[model samples]
Target chain A: MSDWAQLKQALISGDGEELCRRVRQTLDQGVSAKDILNQALIPAMDVVGERMENEDMFIPEVLMAAKAMSAAVEILKPLLAADDLSAAGKVVIGTVKGDLHDIGKNLVAMMMESAGFEVKDLGVDVAPETFVAAARDNGAQLVCLSALLTTTMPMMKETVAALESSGLRDKVKVMVGGAPVTRAFAASINADGYAPDAGSAAKLAKSLVQ
Target chain B: MKSKGRRGGIYRPLTQDQVETIHDAALTILERVGFTYESGLDDLLEMLEGSGARVDREKARIAFPRSLVEAQTAKAPNRVILYGRSEDSHLDLQDDLVHLGTGGAAIKIVDPENGTARPSTLKDVYDLARLVDKLDNIHFYLRPCIPTDIPEAAYDVNVFYACFKGTRKHVMAGVNNEKSFHDVLELAALLADGMDALKARPFFSIITSFAISPLKFCTQSTRIMREANRHGIPVALSCAPMAGSTSPITMAGTLAQIHAEQLAGITVCQLTQPGAPVLYGGIPGMANLKTMGYLGGAVECGMMNAAIHQMAAHVGVPNYNSAGLSDAKIPDAQAGWEKALTIVLAAMGGSNYVHHAAGMLESMLAVAYEQFVIDDEIIGMSCKVLEGIPVDADRLALEVIESVGPGGNFMTSPHTMAHLHDEYFEGNGITDRKSRPKWEKDGAADAWARARRLVERLLSGEETPYISESLDRQIRERFEILL
Candidate 1:
């Protein structure tokens, strides 16, 4: 098979090791790293994303495909031109303070990464100050906050408030989620967008950035 | 399922080993992961300690031994009866009985008058109950819409009163708080003629979400469940664990976590009042990973709840499960398909009380009058399916078949005349069974348009409600009677 076919085939199979190997071989063949990523790797996850939206794919499979994309992206990161490095916008994500849940947040981070965005997961029980600092440090264009508990849902408001107070609210789009978070709740907290799960979160991140 | 067409149903998606695997995992989860009690639940923590479960007081986490959970679970009743105002409407819930009904606290209603959506009021609640009373297939009334306009203090009484006055079919609602729970109990006593009488023949039951998802207890709802238990009122322990969000991503994993939560909630109820009549409610919703909506429309949702019914049956308790709630915003083809798919699964699986079977739309955010009528027709059709094919000499119709042998027409046969009404699917709403030319002659009405007409017809002055004029007046004089 052609090396490009090998890259696409590796992506579909979610073979992280093979995806990285294919990226390396393609680079060795004198192909541009940007072309390998944008043509083979990035578009591969987009297929996974579309399949998921179409219910043709599921969570574990998407996660596996994301793992493959991440493996290939790591190989292309150093060699890619700077413009291709920021091909997808940067996002800062975390579970809000007083909420320790991370599964959903981590899925969002992985989905964002797989969707070609640069993601910095701030981990669980993240305070408002930490979010503002991470967004500043990472130059993130989108901030994603998650909370599993209704009591901790209020912390999302505080985090959004922190951004406003830090004068960075205008510079970035904010998204809120968790089991208890609703579209009405997100709007009430002055959030830029709300997605029910990780795939939509990635879609929202892309829409917000564009 | 002693009814006419009870098939000894064996829809086993999970084998004995798989069920055991889930059961063992649940016990391990309780032992290791434990549950976090919401604040102000020190009494619950104390209860756990007394039961020999480990309690981390400061962190509000409690872990239980498998034996303690099993013993408490074993104390729950195997059979429960929910009475209608009239004796015929009563529900005798067992592992095999399937009761289809409507359930939601929908804040909005698509107005039947003008087909516009608006905030629901106490009258909407009362009217919906009246319509439920009229529908032959909708088995129970669970206050499909929330009376959002009522005052907080009087909401419980008024809501209960509206439902009671509208239909005698068993009404179920969750008390807003412990105090309102007592208030509604008092109102129930008045309707039953006394507190003891109400306890003796409780027509109403409480559906309480005593536990939060991922094995934690919500303090306030737990308190209400306690009050309902102590008062000898039957209750349903409803735990809605959203898959891929609150619970595990795998549907099987979600069921395991759900089984653990349901068992724990049942344990609490039994601990409070031994042999308390409680239904094990495991409404495992899907967090449609794409939308993050707590959806109950998928066929897998039907399978999960059916499996939940089986799990609760395993624990020897009547199961209260949800189905027929569509993610569709309107009563389109999507609504019909989603509702039918889920309700049939629950029914075939033998869930005792399968709710959200009517009127629920937009992922339980809103209800519609036309949708209720359409769902009533769906329920009628699905009930026929649940009545699995009967095998009897008479049903086999040897004589009739012999008489009509060799393609002789059964159209004029006596057996056809006798059995046709009961045997066939007699859909009432706009299912569009008519041919195109005839349908055009009859105005070419869609399901929505036909449903609206049925709603209007059912709400007409001809049908008398279960509540008597004199009794309603007496109750009104006693309570606020906001409606």
Candidate 2:
């Protein structure tokens, strides 16, 4: 099989160890790290993201693909410089404070990466300042905040305001989602967009960047 | 020395020893694998310390308190009557065919065809109210949470008012806090015109949860349960403990743990008021260890509901379990088989009330707006099964049978219409005997898609009964917010 096709097949099946080994082999064979990522990993993940959007892929499959992609990305992270990484737009994401839900945020982050974006996953229970700092430090063009609990949704709005306060609101468009988030809430919070699911979140992120 | 027939029919009451064994098994669950408490960690730890249970401070795991278990068990009620907004809506505790109506799926729909499944709008709430009003078998309505879009505080109040306006029957809703609880009570009081009226007719039941490990209660939820009980309002203590996680892997083990937790809540309610109305409601589902997911399939959920119903019957308290639900979306063969299996067993096993009778799909991860009609049909079929075989002479109707004779259609018989309500439940919208050409002419809408159109029809017009604009504003303004 061709090297790109082999890597694409490996990523789709979530062969994490194989993905890492293949990436290393491709790089050793004089293939650029950027080429391996753009040519093999990104396009493969885009297909996975599309499948998830069409309901052809469910939680477990998407999760596996994300894990495999993460393994492949880890191998390439050091080789690609900050400027080289911007081929995919930079996006910052986190689960708001007082809510420990990370699965939805993680899924969105995975899909975003698959759709060819560099993601700064801030992890769960992230304070507002933490998100603002992540966006600033990563030069992120888009901010995605998620909160699953009804009690913690206010934190998402607070994070958005913090971004605005830091004069980063216009520079970085903000989006929010979770079980409790609604398009009405997004409009109320003055968010750039709201996506109901992980796949939609990725699509919205791509659209925002463009 | 009894005959086989006599032995088969004999009532071998559960011995005190057998009850103690069950009690012991539950205590083991508490002592071994502690229950998960989201809030109230500090309070639960304190309670554990007071009850002489070993507490792991960091993890908040507590060893079981056997003495406390005995004390709580002593206070649990064997039976109680649940009241509605009117005395006429009361559900009597007995072994009979009782069809507690259905509630839609609580989860958000990710991909809807026409209308968006954004956080539930007022339109969704109003539509649900009207649908509940139309379903005859539904004795009570459960205000399923529109979790995604609306503010939880406003969501609670909106659902309570909707249910109150739509039906004179009872409801199960979650109040936001003490203030919301007070406001709902005040509204109920107004509808009845005072505390006396409220006592005579309890419109809604607040759900309470018990601390699983040491068998204690959360301070706020317990407070609401106590207050509701003091005012003679019924409560449903939902102990949704996950097996292999919160309780035990074994079904029997999980049930005993659930029983102990429910008894703890019941004991507290009775402590506040001796004859406090309460429903023994819990969904102690066993986890599929391989998948680490709760199997919401027919066999597992059906058995769980049946077991709980059996235990509740032992106490003579009405059961408010869930039924007419399926793991499938769209009315496929699996949906049909599972829905039929769930409702039939739950109804025949004598569950006094079952919620989730319609519009739930994907293991309750989403509510299919269109599936509600199909679910209603399933509820009707299950209720029909519970009617049992009518052997009476009037039902036999020898003369009517003679006129119909062998191989004759009952459609033209005069006796058919007379016993129609008794013989069969008339299906709503879904069941049809139309020929292909006629059916094709009318637009062949699938059950799910048809339910969607039905929901739109219900939502289009008609204000809820007796809910004046002034009263609604009064109820909306009433709030008790903490933090």
Categorize the docking of model 1.
incorrect
Best candidate according to DockQ: 1
Candidate DockQ values, in order, are 0.19, 0.08
lDDT of model 1 at residue A150?
Answer: 69
Candidate 2 DockQ category? incorrect
Best by TM-score: 1
lDDT of 2 by residue, A23-139 (tens): 999999999888888889988988887777666665566778889988888889899876655666999999998888887788888788777788899899999999999999989
**Per-residue lDDT for B1-483 in model 1, tens only?**
112123313565677788888888888898898898768887777777898899987777888899999999999999999988886688888867778898988888988778777889999898898888888788899998888887767888899998988888899998889888887888888778888888998999999998889888988899999888998889999999889978987888999999999888988898888998999988988886655567879889888988887788888999888999898888888998999998877778888888899999989889998888888888777778766577788889999889899868788998888887777777665577788999899898888988888888888857465666777788788778888
Interface RMSD for every prediction, one decimal?
3.1, 6.9
Q: Native-contact recovery for every candidate?
A: 0.15, 0.00
- TM-score, every prediction: 0.79, 0.71
lDDT of 1: 0.85
Give the alpha carbon lDDT tens digit for every residue of B315-372 in model 2. 5566667766666655566776777777666666666667775666656555655566
Instruction: Compute the DockQ of candidate 2.
Output: 0.08
